[model samples]
Target: MSDKITSIVGARPRGHGEAVARILSLAAAPTFAIMALIAAAAPADMLCAAMQGPLSLQGMVPMYALMSAFHLAPWLRLVR
Candidate 1:
């Protein structure tokens, strides 16, 4: 049984690099959106506390917006 399983596993088709890239791109979409929303809504003080007082959440929103825009452009192209 183990030999049979191993044989089947070995016979399984391999994915192309593009497939992995697409999967990763899709996975990042929602994460970027969520991060954008969180950064936009989170208080700067809270972010500062979480970052041990080095970073500010006020800056997070713009950064997240840019990241979200970067992710969104590809998705929009895919959708169209």
Candidate 2:
């Protein structure tokens, strides 16, 4: 398709989250490294305790579990 046609049709475009995901992908390694360092340096107990006061267990656990599955799916196998 030509650019003129696309422009005339008002091409559907990336959403805000998609754009943010692109930016995040560009910096994921450094971001992960910094996060890892922070986690490593923080006291183990404090890491778990830190989020309790502000975060709800009902939402946090399931969200992290789902995200963990998404991130780990490539390396995981399901026999069933």
What are the lDDT figures for the candidates, one per model?
Answer: 0.61, 0.45
TM-score for candidate 1, please give it: 0.53
Structural similarity to truth (TM-score) of each candidate: 0.53, 0.30
Tell me which residue pairs clash in candidate 1: none
lDDT tens digits by residue: candidate 1, 1-80: 54453343343324544454555676676787788798657765764657653444346666776777777755676567
Q: For model 2, how does the per-residue alpha-carbon lDDT over 23-44 read when each residue is reduced to its tens digit?
A: 4443444444455556545654
Candidate 1 yields a Cα-based lDDT of 0.61
What range of 10 consecutive residues in model 2 has the weakest lDDT sum? 71-80
Ten consecutive residues with minimal summed lDDT in candidate 1?
A: 5-14
Error of 1 at 41 (Å): 3.3
Top-TM-score structure, candidate number = 1
Name the runs in model 2 displaced over 4 angstroms: 1-21, 46-80
